[model samples]
Target chain A: MDLRVEFAGLVLKNPIITASGTFGFGLEFSSFGDLKRLGGIVVKGLSLKPREGNAMPRIVETPCGMLNAIGIQNPGVEAFLKDKLPLLPWRETAIIANLYACSVEEFGDLAGVLSGEEGVAALEVNVSCPNVTHGGAAFGQDPAQITKATEAVKKRCGNKPVIVKLSPNVTDIAVCARAAEAGGADALSLINTLLGMAVDIKTRKPVLANVVGGLSGPAIKPVALRCVYQACRAVGIPVVGIGGIASAEDALEFITVGATAVEVGTANFLRPDQSFRIIDDLPRAMLKARAADMAELRGSLVLPGQ
Target chain B: MVVRNCREVKVQSVRFLGTWDEASDFVELTLENPGWESYRPGQFAMLRPKHWGLELPWGRPFSISRLDAETLTVFFQVIGRGTSRLARLNPGDEVVVWGPLGNGFSAPPETPTLLLAGGMGIAPFRGYIENHPTPEFLRLFFAHRVPLANYPYLAMAEKVRAEAMQEHTPEDLPRIIERIRELMDENHGGIALACGPTPFMRTIQEHAVAGGLRAELSLEKSMACGVGACLGCVCKNGEGKHVQVCARGPVFQADAVQL
Candidate 1:
């Protein structure tokens, strides 16, 4: 059972990439499993300058999920390149940098900073983070801004494949996917957490200090699959499915629905070794799904009345 | 700086040793040790029942109340949906346990140490008292809203010089605060270690900082991953920068964190 997946100018040993934010710098989880075993590692969201993020009580647990307003707290791209990136096993696995910025030019500047590093295999443009006040879901919710941000990163990102991660908060996700495609994104990953909120009825206050946050985990799997399905049909570029992917079967569900690969997010918190477990289980899962390889299963969803 | 124990953190599926009500809502649970390195006082673990489904996605974090060669113990109150579910588990059930996590409470053996516990805040002191090299140098001052019998006061009282005070109302806080100040004065240059609700810990922090007394606080925050990766359980340090409680500490020095 070959789990290799080739998409967006990168060939992964498997379709199991740890999503940004949840997996930290990839060094934190080194004790749980071998990092080289995974297909890719999308590190924590990085910016041109270090971000302090939201105030305390930034995350709250929801039903079978969690809402987080981390605001992309990171040590900036320079710190990552100097202090963190050299320590990662990027030679064995794809180290995709997830870029977060408040402006289009800043996104390009961040991409340019990372694109020169041989360790960085790709740049994931995060215009869909719902936790921040600016340049997050604001840019993702608008198709024009999505095009502009994607184009700016593409222009400065040298030869590194640019993946536009789309938000699910918008009314029409397919339109956003098409907008990224129009701006020359090599691939698309959807959906970056749904906009949600939780309140403490006793105190009559919001659970998260940020008031609203992005919801992730098993609760959002169906929504992520729907968004990925629609986006895959709407765009010519390959789609990488993310959201609530905890097991090999969950990853296959995304692959079956037209996604070339899948990224495990919140489940990384549930079980630290979840991504490695999924990769180990994929061969058996492929056997159970009656597919010899990912290519045979990719986009194999049978529509109604087919 | 507190000397931290170097231990390998691992996740294991261990057998549940059942749970019992310690006092009213307070419950104590035991589990078979998962064969990791021995943990120190104030270290914690993330626990989730193996049978749990999507209804409860993440594991709950608890301080290690006691640990022996065969099993480990944790104390928690039924405050929310997670603990209520945890209180009903049967023996022989499998549970996913991770850690011996975070920096635990630490002080030199010869130094006189004041252990201030607020209600359920007494959980970690059991391990601390049991492991302390010189028990004569430790003093425990416990303050609670509930009856003194509702906590592990009597058991801890036998081991060290212990005192209990009841705060029946907000007005009673001054008496408790006065008692804590007296204890700090008695211990003089000794260090104060506290664990409790935010208000209780805050009071300790304020008084400890003001009187020039050295202190360490065990903070409680809702955490997703017991590791620092989630960045969910961060508290501001004295520098006003957010530091992860799960990684940097659940136990922080008096002046280190803003409280």
Candidate 2:
């Protein structure tokens, strides 16, 4: 009753889950905030092997968003399989394994390995990570490729739900949404970081060593709301909206716009306790919105005349 | 027993302590919060210079150079965007400030002390000179490389020496060992405190151990969550257990660290 949210196949206890890349794994932040209380956790971006990632200056600050080119620097799947997951104080929280690859086979191979493994409740077919150079943004940018990766993993995953993470970097996000939906994605999380960059004036250099990076924060709030609103209308599946979510009000904005759920990204870095803060504030937010239940708040927004 | 609130600060001033060619900017900050009770010489604070709407602050772990009750001094090399933007900051700009957290160098009851820092690592040494300066019980050895131009506070090295019978050496640096040995001889039984890259700290720790001197070291790690949840900032200790450099330390007893 306190913090639960319902998705297609899962009944999440709270809507306050740690977004991928930012939370690292459940092991470290457990000391700061109880990971068990989270709706779930999306661990670091994993491919087949551990990645050293880009050179120095992997992260930079924009006006309100951050440009990070860590290029998904994770200790590949095997290392994560061995080192990171076992340590989480997971309890009942859903542990979502986020997988990425340049080729369809790599996604399939990686998904095949994780499908039967312990502790993973779902597989987030990640074709939308904007930071890396190769397969990530490429596959995510094209709807055809989005379907290709989704179908590949769907063939490998037996009972697990494959939630495709969609990129807002595209011209038409719903085009990519339909592709994932068509390819049998059980669910979708929209609006990954919008690609962006900031430059230094006196020196005349681009801020990130990678030249450009994903932008996330309060600045992107409206864009995220618009994207989620449209995607929810287009898709036949649940949509988890993410972008510039900093407060309970910000989260409710996503839910009202038709997002079945929402993922808080850049805000978690500002305050480690932010997720819990949102959890505490959600019920009051529901009360303020005058919704009897969380689901009633979903799609509560109306157009000018509708 | 305590709840620390995160505060956003603005950059009031950013300037090279010496010359522009040095690429070092000592950023002065003013935030909504006044600050924590007097910080230690080697303590560091994490900062997010206004812009990077990131949920997390991306400030590098830097030592507190100088602090008046209202502001904190953060010295950084203008290597990347964070520092370059920080360099552009004039008075009245704002940033998100969190810290004065982590283990600071122990200056226990002023038994006797030797302070060493390299390059921009000279930050915390200035704090020690200002805050922990004691007359007879503690002695200091402040050394850095050439072009002691912008850093006028090297003068503080001499001031600490006047009372503690200290030795001041600003060497071209093949003489770094010679200068340190000379100071150690004059001030035996002194506790050695150091900060720099791992190798620099390792060299100082070895020298201190070889001479049977006491020492403390500050460590650095790549961190996103400075308060320790990310586990991104992990460093191997002597026991081979990976410890959170942010929560477990930025400061550790010299010999206890594996490095």
Q: TM-score of B chain for each model?
A: 0.90, 0.83
Tens-place lDDT digits, model 1, residues B1-259: 3222212222222223222344337667777776654677888888887777876778889999988777777887778888888777777777777777888998679899999999889999998999899999999999988776656678899999999999889899999988988888788788899999888888888888888889999999888888888899899999999889998899999899987
Error of 1 at A221 (Å): 1.0
DockQ, candidate 1, comes to: 0.44
What are the clash counts of all predictions, listed in order?
Answer: 0, 22
List-wise, what DockQ does each model earn? 0.44, 0.21
Residues B101-191 of candidate 2 have per-residue lDDT tens digits of 6778887665777776655666677777777757445455444443555454455656566211122453335466566656655567768
Candidate 1 clashing pairs? Answer: none
- In angstroms, the error of model 2 at A279 is 1.4
DockQ of structure 2:
0.21
Candidate 2 error regions (>4 Å): A129-137, B1-43, B47-113, B118-139, B143-193, B196-224, B227-259
lDDT of 1 at B145: 83
